[model samples]
Target: MTPITEVEGRRLALSNLQKVLYPATGFTKGEVLHYYATVADALLPHLRDRALSFLRYPDGPDGQVFFAKNVPPGTPEWVTTARVPRSDGPARMVVVQDLASLVWAANLVTEFHTPQWVVQEPEIADRLVLDLDPGAPATVVECCEVAVWLRERLAADGIEAYPKTSGSKGLHLLAAVRGASSERVTEYAKRLAVEAEEAMPGLVVHRMTRSLRPGKVFVDWSQNAARKTTAAPYTLRARAEPAVSAPVTWDEVARCRSADPLAFLAADIAPRLQDHGDLLAPVLDADRAGSVP
Candidate 1:
């Protein structure tokens, strides 16, 4: 029988609470739900108004996995969803608005949550993301070096950016921008990547080719496209261990250059939140907005 728990007055039916989701860390399904519940206050703001794409690992990290763009059939009507028009047709995507909606998604073993960069209008974007992907032999430390350099460049342009772990191997830097067409955002990101590559010839590469990645970080500005989605901050990754896509301080990034690559994990997020109180909060602020062009 499925055990039901009431979260802030909303009855949430949970299943497989004892099922192990991360064998390396012995993290269970219940713990995943609990993490979301605990961080819901901080996590929900990022998810609100964004179309969610669920990456589910029903069995565990070692088990079968699949991606679902639309909220699965039988999703409770109480949960809010947005019908966004696609080239094929309009698809309904889940919008995590409150604790109830968050836990409901976690109950489905949703390991990673990804959202569009824009709100409501799927074809527009209000944020610019630069995904720093380090190739083999080039660790996250190298990515951090490149990120700090890029951050300085963006700052010179009057853009305030925030940094966060990719929850796997890379890092993502985001900045709030005036709402613009997706093409405009993508082009702006591309130009920035090109300039970075030119400024630091061998250290940064804007191209996506793997051959050029060794000992260098790839500035993946292409993520700014309308169809592309990056992992939502504070969501758990599907690594052998339960690592989270956590927001970090610029100071932490500088320190990580000489520290562990996977320095942040699911267990580390809450305390950091208590200390820093959502470092990425400014990205959502309308008054803090900047533009790529």
Candidate 2:
């Protein structure tokens, strides 16, 4: 067994994560590294004290790697490992079967992907997206500032919200809730977006249309249905240095340009998943209950 350092462990884990990720997403070989790094950084933190593992798809055929959960004797494979399917393709996915297998798993498949569009779970969600160019000439500080404001308001509503770096110059705030229809969810989302824009005036923009929202934050509410799309968690984006849809706390979102939710990696992601684990849970409930009517 290779003695592992923290850095080595992360590398191994990421390599393993790639196997299921590659062919599923059809990511080209060149896009793998950034995708892996982004997901590794965001998800690693939450993986503590758990039996965790990953698979990777490096290049060419036979590039798939797999890991069995690094657990004590007698643990079940099904209990310790899981396969997360990529929304892009039904059969395509990244497998994180266990921990020690990290090193061997990085060899399968190829390509890195960023969502031009992404599909999310079925259900309505109350979402507030702060869209902006993190790499623009403007300061990331300004972007973070807006996130702080959004976080505060959402928190006040007793919403259990999660943040994701948009893999671009923006951030997404996903709130899980119940008892809301799609229409109500969309209305609530618009209300929140409008309110945020009103609160900051020029600091944030809520216009969803590209032509209208040239250089401002647009509170996107479109990710609110069964087939609707949002950036996939940990999926590598199409950028030069790809960014994943990393989870973040309000504090981190409020403070950093890129707050890596490295703590919430796959090993821990399962535990965090609620009954209707996806963000749309609450809104779906509302709609089903006729909240919109």
Candidate 3:
């Protein structure tokens, strides 16, 4: 029988604890639970009041994976949700506001993704993001270079940016911005991408056309759109190994040149939190958010 554990007054039946979720690394469901529970303090702030788009891999990362928008069937009553209108119709998405809900979702082996805005302000963006993705022949090392340029460019615009590993390839540069509509941020991000392409030429590509991607870093600026979502920081990705979308320091982003930098795994987050206490913490402060200009 699966054991039932009480977390913050919620009785969660965390099943399949011994089941491996990352076949290559033998990481189990139990480890996933532990990682979320351990990173809760640093992770929850980024997720609270934000509607989630979960990617569930019930059969492990190597097996079938499905996207979950509405709350999973049988979600507990205490779990928070936001009913937002979609192009098709109204949709209810889970808001993993606390430790209990997070663990419950992790129990289902989910990879968390959230939009740039919060539930309270759906169409307005609180953050701007640029996903610096590299095509083959170019690795995250190339992404690091582009991120540094983008960071400086953003800073000149008075927006402070933070870096994180995409947990797959490349880097993500995010900055908290004040009172801008999703369209505004999206357009601003696109302008930056285009500017970077102009500045770097062969080193960067702004458009998503597949043929133009190779040997260049594609500055994906569309994650700022109201409907688009980004992987929540500290969330595990469904990969062959248990890689995480972990935050990094500017120092790490600046000096990262093939020194095998910015790669973080599930087991690496707890210690990182202890040392840095969430490098992205400033990005969570709405009051301190800079203008999108």
Each model's lDDT comes to 0.84, 0.43, 0.91
TM-score of each: 0.95, 0.48, 0.98
Give Cα distance to truth, residue 202, candidate 1, Å: 1.7
Q: 191-290, model 1: which lDDT tens digit per residue?
A: 8889989988878899998889888889998878777778888998888988888898898888885536445777888998999998899999979988
Runs in model 3 lying further than 4 Å from the true structure: none
Mind giving the per-residue lDDT tens digits that candidate 3 earns over 181-224? 99999999999999999999989999999899999999999999
Candidate 3 clashes between residue pairs 3 or more apart in a chain or in different chains: none
Top candidate when judged by lDDT against the true structure: 3
The weakest ten consecutive residues by lDDT in model 1 span: 111-120
Model 3: worst 10 consecutive residues (lDDT sum): 253-262
